[model samples]
Target: DSFNAFMSLNERAARSALLDIQKALGPFRNERVLAATAVTDMAISSLQRRSVTIYLAPNITDMTVLRPLLTLFVQQVMDLLTREHNPDALPVYFLLDEFRQLKKMDEILNKLPYVAGYNIKMAFVVQDLKCIDEIYGETARHSLLGNCGLQLILGANDQVTAEYASRALGKRTIRYQSETRTLELFGRARRTRVEQIRERDLMMPQEVRQMREDKAILLVEGQRPILASKLRYHAIEPFKTAALASRQNTVPVPDVEMARALPVPATLPDYAVDGPDPRPGRIELDRHEVIDDAAFEASSAENVDAAVSSKERLVVTARKLKSVIAACLSAADMPMNQRISIQDVLAKTIPDPEEVGLD
Candidate 1:
């Protein structure tokens, strides 16, 4: 009784929150979110695993749906790492590109430290540090930077990132030498020795800001900052070949003629029973008659020609309908045997033209 009471409260809270968000979804019209919330008890590890790619196209403007999807994925991956009882699970690589797009990223950043133990690793790709700091706040920003084992900082134009990089490198001591020789009118020259010397940042903020595009700073724990040249992937031997291989040509336009030529599958009883069954073929019409549906029963010769043309069109339409129904049945989630039975019943239920001719 107590457990059920707590569960009811939990359900109420969840429903209120989830429904509010679901109401704003324009793409999921005519569908209730409750059906999506239904859960089945099963072992997650039993499912055949494959690489999961969550590509958020730039065109997607709705963060409400996209953020939840991304959060769910990240949470599941992190959960896998937490399963100490199931250590045999396959390792997962959670790569988040353009990380700023997702909201409430601090939760994920906090889990980064513990992920490695569960065979899960995450790579968060951001354009700049400021982008994340603004979203996750300064505390989360620091935690993220501190937890990462290695950092490759490319040339940064932003003052905040450049200054952060300078501070991150720590201080270095270098010899200072200066000679100030000034000869005033009828005065002797004065020289100053290299007496003023102190520790200074290894790389100044301005220097880091003006760094060459090809140059990057490689920072590793317990190791001196190394200035390295960025790899030119397009020009590299193996990478260049791979890059060219991955390139795709622009998609061609659809063929309207080919689409129009596609025939629909359906059946008509009139064509099956009648002697003349002209369907999906050339309809021989009398030049004197205009093939009018209203004059199908006319006793004149023109009426007879119109009736034949009308019958031919009806048979073609029936065939098209049959094809559509078959496709619909196949697409349904019902069992194969059940679907076949339903389709058979549908075929038989179509009234015979001889028994009930079109009025």
Candidate 2:
């Protein structure tokens, strides 16, 4: 009786389905298809669990191929944070170097303000405020900047960054006095003194731009901002030696707790399998989906047989499929699965037991 349900797949319907698939897959029929699927180690769960995970772009020259891949990986990382987090877990700090270069993470960054509660921390290393404004626009840029508990500005060579840094550090009120001495012909007939209070930026925009390499601004929540000395790590003890070693090695992991330097592979390893699940009660996530009638019709576009009512269409198509059923029966000697493919284009359905002579 299951065969009776899918009794509407006529030649026109089949052609429509084929055309839809062609349209969807048309743009993907290129050499780049391999590059899209080449990345196999997209397992975000285990990678998120590690003390440190790095996504090294294979070729920066091919940004067309690379940025989208980076965007996909970043999305997976964001998704992992949503579903997987322990209450007692330490903050998983994601330090995005060259934050402006990555695209399509605007939506992800929009939610970063609230995700800090999930033990997720984001350190965006941006060159200037203009880049953030250009990439993410004003609203998302505000959200990203508002979420920062600590803002460390090393150098502000650009006016945009310098201005933003100046504003963020805030203003201070200063009191000063001015005395006016009278000349006989002047408007002031007598000496008078006046005191005035004016607000000035804690650090002016020009001052920020002119800040030396050794100097930096540190802005902390609920505290006065500081113009502090940037740590001269090259002059520091262990860091000095580590910096020397980094010139010879690729990854210069500093001497710290759980700082193990592992060799980055040319291609990330893929531990995924295509076979059926071995677990008894595992949910089948990759099975064929049942498309509803309305959805199928919408995707197929305006039907060729608009005059045929759906019920009549099913009856007519079933009558037309008699030849297909006969062809399937001719292959009855073959395995059931082999015989089943004889006329699959007609419909995805089962043959009645009486029609197949099974009973």
Candidate 3:
């Protein structure tokens, strides 16, 4: 019933549905088939009570689709925690790694300042400040840093972030002393000492950039920044040896199996279909059809070049379309969660430009 409501629309309805605000769902969809499913607010409630949960990226896939999915999952869980838990409830720690990869979370991030009242804390691991600025813009970056009462500056590779860390740590007064001695009279030596107190950054920008991996600068509100060494996780009990063994125990999956299991779309994009035949002019339109070796070799280099160029252009067009869709979705007033299903359907509908001729 739901599948028919989604796929069995008139041409006008279908066209309008292309930009339908309802398609923006975050979770639960038929990616391998043409279908739709409803997502409820309680979908992520179970995660709210889970002690430990780790969300990892789908390996080797483009991150565009996964971004909204993860964001929705986190947002829904946070909402549940805020609604159900009291201040005395066990604290929830949201450990988000490479947080800049997700989109449409600025609203949730803005609300993070109040999450602590509900006994929920968040630790965002990012490569650099520039990542947030480039993705979420300057306002969000400021809001995030401003709300963080404690900031840790780790050994960084970028000069900008290093300088930021240096500035944020503020300056300290240092005493400098210079001593000089002269023995001109041969019998006695006179010494002169001059001391001066000057204010300078506790950690210079260059120093922050060159800081060792084991060391980091910790800045807490109303206190001077302190340099601290990091403790290796493996050095801790239970996590060290067990973690290493678990990492080593992972087995690799075959490429074919991995591709089949990946939740990608089943149909080709309309733009990628090569006319009615869906194949090159030389090939027959049957599933079991094959060309003779001699006939295959008879293809001229020009035809091959043309096919390759067409495929490349198709790829460029698909990327441009994705950009357009992202921009449209961002500018729309619809909810981020509601927009995800639409995005997923659009992703599946795109044709594989490389699927040409026979095999």
Candidate number with greatest TM-score: 1
Identify the candidate with maximal lDDT: 3
For model 3 the local lDDT of residue 211 reads: 88
What are the per-residue Cα lDDT tens digits for candidate 1 across 258-339? 2223232323334445555443333445548687654543445554566677777678767866876777767689776655
Sort by TM-score, best first. 1, 2, 3
Relative to the true structure, candidate 3 has a C-alpha RMSD (angstroms) of: 19.8
* TM-score (C-alpha, index-matched) for candidate 2: 0.56
Predictions ranked by lDDT, top down? 3, 2, 1
In candidate 2, which residue pairs clash? none
Worst 10 residues of 1 by lDDT: 257-266
Per-prediction TM-score, please? Answer: 0.56, 0.56, 0.54
lDDT of 3: 0.71
Which scores better on TM-score, 1 or 3? 1
The lDDT of each candidate is: 0.68, 0.70, 0.71
Tens-digit per-residue lDDT, 215-294, candidate 2 = 88998988989889977778987999999888778875697633234444422233124443223222223346766767
lDDT of candidate model 2 versus the reference: 0.70
